[model samples]
Target: MQSDSKILAKINQTVDRLSDPESYDLVCHEHRLGEPLPSTEKLAKIVNMIREILFPGYFGTTSLRPNTIKHYMGVYVDELFELLSEQIMAGLCFTCKNPHEVDMQERNRHAQMLASEFIAYLPEIRRKLVADVDTAFVGDPAAQSQSEVIFCYPAIRAISNYRIANQLLKLEVPLIPRIISEMAHSETGIDIHPKAEIGESFTIDHGTGVVIGSTCIIGNNVKLYQGVTLGAKSFPLDEDGNPIKGVPRHPIVEDGVIIYAQATILGRVTVGANSVVGGNVWVTNNVPPNSKIVQFKARETSFSDGAGI
Candidate 1:
């Protein structure tokens, strides 16, 4: 019912308001003019390539034989190196506060070096992931084989992402590690922070709604079930009322511990080695080694004779 010219003018006014720099300055990321941003699609491809390399015939190539495995590994490694280096460079550029001050050539060389170092570390990652898969297969009676665990379990997928992202975090290549971890979170409903220090032989069963926070130090051979949250109980706020960053706030889970479904462990508490935390329990204090923490049983009430009391 409005005039075409008037509607166009109104739309132009809204566009002008949205284009105002003042409106989005706080949230906007202003990067170098020609620098590339990190791409989630490319990172997803990188993850898939890493999986294919790690699991061989289990992932990408069905026709892979022992004789030709080396050839496939070579091809995957080359492609992964190219993709990873570019993403690392993009991450570096994305986090640079003053991009003009950075030497682009040196940054590219550094990214390439990091990618090569990561490639060399692939064997170590594979070793840890093998342990994880074995643990998952052994722990779950429903799992027929380690290969089945590798192919069917969401925990393996989530843990693989965490391992890769944690290695990248160790290399101090910003942005990409968190992105990689979040990709797994989106797919598996399991959120393991890249900064969390998780040891080998870890397994999560029925892994939905699991949240492992940054600064959580999980020991070797630990297992967690669904709906488990290892999170901070409270944040230490600064004068500006913002939570302080880089503080060790999450729980430290020791070796051989099993946290059952829906357990919430918060703050900087320690769950000692070989402990079993029962389901739906809220733990905030330090638990001793070889302890079992469970909820108190519900009471049964006796009723008087009907309408006679």
Candidate 2:
């Protein structure tokens, strides 16, 4: 008991020191105010709850009937709206930071409105996501059905999270979009920044190690294979050699572009429409429309037909 009390005392002292303005002045200047929310697990559950509601029988309790499903969804939607409203309000308050002005009521109203708007978009999102499911099905042979993809595929999981996060981002709610994507990242090993403009009919095949960075503008019907990275080859660095923040650093893949496995197309370069970028290729320059890039003379062999020493 004595040791526990001493440990608690030490933790309190450390927290107090951290809370001191002077002690944290330099760091605080670099970072700003953002009140922490519930854990990512909690957020993930909320997201999954939303998914279960949106796509009935695909996620969460599978035993629900079509009749009872709406009732369950209404309950989940209410709970999600409540929790998301609180989190969004916290985000707004954190970002407002005026200190002299804190309008919690107005922020709450806006948050509620945003939540309502996001809920309204669910049907359209589902419609677009159906196209994604079709793309995935036609793109990959292993997928049994749309139901299988919805229930088991990481690509679907990641895409679902991205769509949800993208809607929140469009609503201009800060921090939550990134958190939602990072949750999908943790689950699926695919890192798609919420700010990346991805179009409908997008599919990620065998999605592990696929990274779509911020500023990546993906057009419709874009398909990416595993280990493909649409990232910047080089960042515009500051005087201190740190990469400049918020620059357009990723590729803009035009519509109908197929990026195969392990292909790294970097920078603000535009991959023109109907292009096929093959595996293990590093592309920095702009690819012309309908261009096919593949490995050349990369394989080595020794002839065994000749009678040699």
Candidate 3:
């Protein structure tokens, strides 16, 4: 009875509060929404599945017959188009202030067209990505096969996805490019901005902690080691002391340059062709062609010998 009385008292108090004049005006609007959009992991998995089907045995599951491959790809492409279109519309709506006036049909149509174009570009993307794999294989002696590079190399995965998404970004299809690049970043720990311009024949060895910032222009035959960061030093600030956006941040690495492990090359400085940046060096100034930079008083040591005495 005491428990019942306590419950009744609480209910009566709530009713009384709702009936109050101030509380009545305060009760404005509320509605329960559905589950949020699909996660980046799931989206990435879908993309991976599509890539696998498109370039069979390259990524994801490899079990399939010759006849079934076409059917499976068709199904996945259909589903991807649907899911991508929905997510794109959601992104478009999120960015728009006047959401109701935004046309879902137009957005969906544009997304579908871009998605098709992206699908068509896959063959060319694969052709270019094969060169990246070749570069990695030829550059790294430990790399066994093209398959190994495709499966185990983080740089290939990150760069391949970036190039694929960059084409779409260049087409100006909105938020999908950033989403795709972030998906790669989460998986590989290699954060390459989609806007960064990278040339052909680029290879990254043991690519962890690799960050290539936006506005970076990397040329052909460039090789990067793990933990190498091509970044900007500082941005020019506005009158309010806020950092300005879209300035020429990050370095311009010319063709045939090699940057060793843990090197941080910053600013709009250019590293000319055939230049070699040694490990653990912080470079802010421009480097002329054929320049080799190594740390002062550094001695060569083997991996088994343990670093420094």
Candidate 4:
């Protein structure tokens, strides 16, 4: 055992080494003096508030009545605006290359404007969410009702998060959208990138392990199952050997396509409209419209007595 003085000295030395700027300069985040950082807790609250506003009587503490619905909406919208504006400001500051040169007051006003615009888009978001809930209810035979789907389905939660994040991404609010999407990904095992272009009435059954990559265009009425991977096959490298960014590298699924569980569709291939991709298949090429792709049958084996000779 070491002496008390020696132990304290060793601990101090370790702390000093760890705190050295050279140790973490590459990955360290050094923000402007007064600029705020995005808070996951606040973003989570924002998501909950959106859900409550979108599906009244389904989330939050308020017992909503027909006459008071507008009042509740007003309150929720007001709160959401403030929270969103703060987070958006934080996101703007987080991405600023020259924080010293930028006007903080102007940025704050811009954030407030973006928040107001997002609030105005709430009705549209609610419309899409209602469609999604209806689709889930109609598509799943086991679903008792649309209410049940909204109350219980992980797919609903994931898709709702994606929809909200997608809208934010469209508004070009950086960092925050990705954070919102990732919050859902952590809770539900579905990973839909905010940049992914997914149309209305999209459903993911048993959504765990589903991965929809950025640049993937999924058409309306498309369905996916568990363990499905709509991912990139290979990266197109630059002259300096870095993988090129923003290239279309993931598969595009056209309208009315159904991809079964564990199917892996890679590269920039197009799965045409009304196609059905069967379970556990590996697809790297284009699938024609109305085509059905499935794995070949396994070979049969005969045993001599209890074991093969």
Question: Whole-model lDDT, candidate 1?
Answer: 0.95
Clashing pairs in 1: none
Clashes of each: 0, 0, 0, 0
Query: Deviation in angstroms for 225 in model 1?
Result: 0.2
lDDT of 3 by residue, 201-280 (tens): 89989889999998999999999999999998988999999999999989999999999999999999999999999999
What is candidate 1's lDDT per residue for 1-309, written digit by digit as tens? 999999999999999999899999999987667787999999999999999998888887635788888888888899999999999999999998877788999999999999999989999999999999999999999999998999899999999999999999999999999999999999999999999999989999989999999999999999999999999999999999999999999999999999999999999999999999999999999999999999999876666775433
Deviation (Å) of 177 in candidate 2 = 0.5
Model 1 CA lDDT for position 205: 100
Residue 275's C-alpha lDDT in candidate 4?
A: 99
Displacement of residue 261 (Cα, Å) in model 1 is 0.4
Collision pairs in model 3: none
Better of 2 and 3 by TM-score: 2
lDDT of 2: 0.85
* Top candidate, metric TM-score: 4
Q: Which stretches of candidate 3 lie over 4 Å from their true place?
A: 1-38, 63-69, 299-309
Cα displacement (Å) at residue 72, model 3: 4.0
lDDT score at residue 62, model 4, on the 0-100 scale: 71
TM-score of each: 0.95, 0.85, 0.80, 0.97
Best by lDDT: 1
CA shift of 242, model 2, Å: 6.6
Tens-place lDDT per residue, model 2, 1-309, is 579889999999999988889987766533344443445666777788877876877788845687776778778888888878777766666566574575556767988898888888988888888899888988778878887877777998899899889989999988888899999999999999998999989999889999999899999999999999999888788999998899998999999999999999988899999999999999999999999999886665576877352
- Candidate with better lDDT, 1 vs 4: 1
lDDT of each residue in 1-309, candidate 4, tens digit only: 999999999999999998999999998888668999999999999999999998888888877798998898888899899999999999999999888799889999999999998888988988888888888889999999998999899999999999999999889999999999999999999999999999889899989999999999999999999999999999999999999999999999999999999999999999999999999999999999999999998979898887975
